[model samples]
Target: MSADCLFCKIVAGEIPADVVHETGATLAFRDIGPKAPVHVLVIPKAHHADVAALAVTDPALAGEVLAAAAEVARKEGLLAHGYRTIFNTGGYGGQEVFHVHAHVVGGAPLGPMLSPR
Candidate 1:
């Protein structure tokens, strides 16, 4: 993990967050700035800049993140209907934070607002 990374700090417990769930390899928390009623983010404890970078050498970790995301969506009560798992990569994809995180959004009508802002 990069020492200067914000997500790393949150994973290390140096920073406080509204954590919803966590495991040995991952951490799930409410988005500080949520866009939906059930907006949560699941991320690996290790620091990865983005999903594209994560897939290059850490496919297993990538799988873990995705699996955990689905689990959180179910746990957060979005399974019966539906939810969206978004991983914005790079600046063009709206990845403002240089950390690989899965956004599990639900509990609302997510019709046309998913496009890049």
Candidate 2:
């Protein structure tokens, strides 16, 4: 784990988070600045720069992250309605944190993936 990575800190308990679920390889927590009613961040406990890095270097861990996202969505009661899992890669993808993570959002009608052009 990188000493400077925020999500790593949270996974290590060096920094506090509203952790909702956890597995041997993954951690799920509420987003501090949520974009949806059930916005949660699912991350691999191991440090990865981003999703692509995780996919290339640690695919097993990446799968764990996806499993955790689905678990969080089920626990949050989003499956009955619907839920979306997002992975923002790099700066252009809107990834504020460098760690590999997935955002599980639901609990309401999210509507369009983007505004109509």
Candidate 3:
């Protein structure tokens, strides 16, 4: 885990977060800035700068992240109704934190996936 990464800190227990789920390879937590009624961030335990980095470095771990995201959605009671999973890759993609994480959002109609640019 990178000492400077926020998600890494949370994984390492150096930081506190509203965690929702965890596995040997992944961690899921509530987003501090929630966009939906249910918003969770699912991440791999190992540090990855972004989705691309995670994919290239450890593809299986990347899959684990996705699986964890689904689990979060299910646990949040949005699975049967459906939900959206998002990965903002970089700054241009709207990624604020460097760590690779998936946003699990649902619990209500989310409207359009994105606003018109």
Candidate 4:
């Protein structure tokens, strides 16, 4: 984990978050600054840093994170219609938080994607 990453701090309990779920290897929480009504995030507890960094040797760990995200989506009632999951890697994709996270968003109709503010 990077020394100054915001999410690493949260995972370390050095900061606070509206955590929704936590397991042996991951944590799920409500996104403080949400993009959609039901937005939430699933992150690896061990701190892998970024999606671009995932590798074949890490497949099992990576699968755990994805499964945890799906579990959170189902629990949040976002499945009957559908949900959108995204990982914004690095700066170009708008990853303000450096710690890798999967965004789980959807419930009601999203209407339209907002233009970047």
Candidate 5:
């Protein structure tokens, strides 16, 4: 675990987060800044720079992250209407935290995937 990484601290219990779900390999928590009615962040217990890094270095753990996100959606009652899972890759991708994480957002209509350019 990267000592300076925020998500790693969260995983290590050094920092506090509103965790929603957890597994042997993953942790799901509520986003501090919620963009939708439900916005949760799912991350692997292990540290990885970003989604691409995680996918390349440990695909199985990446799958566990996705599975945890799905479980969060189900428990949040978003399965009927559907939910969105996002992985912001880097600076250009709007990833503020370096640690790999999946943003599971739903509970209302998210008008567009991105702003119209």
Candidate 6:
């Protein structure tokens, strides 16, 4: 784990988060800043720079992250209506934290996937 990474700290219990779900390999927590009625961040217990890196280095763990996100969405009651899972890669992708995480958001119409340019 990267000592300076915020998600790593959350995983390590050094920082507090509104955790929603957890598994041997993953953790799901509510997002501090909610863009939708339900917004949770699902992450792997192990650290990776980003989703792409995680996919390349440890595909199994990456799949675990997705599974956790799906579980979070189910727990959040978003399965029937629908939900969105996002992984912001780098700065251009809007990833603030370096640790790989999946944002599971739903509970209402989220509108367009991105702002119309």
Instruction: Pick the winner on TM-score between candidates 1 and 2.
Output: 2
Model 2 C-alpha lDDT versus the unseen true structure? 0.92
For each candidate, what is the lDDT?
0.90, 0.92, 0.91, 0.83, 0.94, 0.93
Query: Which residue pairs collide in model 6, if any?
Result: none
lDDT of 3 by residue, 9-84 (tens): 9999999999899999999999998998999999998888999999998999998898888788878899788899
Better of 2 and 5 by TM-score: 5
Q: Kindly state the number of residue pairs that clash in model 3.
A: 0
Q: Tell me the tens digit of each residue's lDDT in model 2 across 1-117.
A: 999999989988999999999998899999999988999999999899999999999888888888889899999999898999999999988999999889999988999997797
Candidate 5 per-residue C-alpha lDDT over 3-62 given as tens digits, one digit per residue, 9 for 90 to 100:
899999999999999999999999999999999999999999999989999989999998
TM-score, one value per model: 0.94, 0.96, 0.96, 0.87, 0.98, 0.98
State the number of backbone clashes in model 1.
Answer: 0
How far off is residue 79 in model 6, in Å? 0.7
Q: Name the weakest run of 10 consecutive residues (lDDT summed) in model 2.
A: 58-67
Clashes per candidate (backbone, < 3 Å): 0, 0, 0, 0, 0, 0
Q: 1-117 in candidate 4: lDDT tens per residue?
A: 667888888888998989988899889999988878889999988767677665344777788889999999889988898898888888888887777799999877776565667
lDDT of 6 by residue, 29-97 (tens): 999999999999999999999999999999999989988898898898999999999999999999999
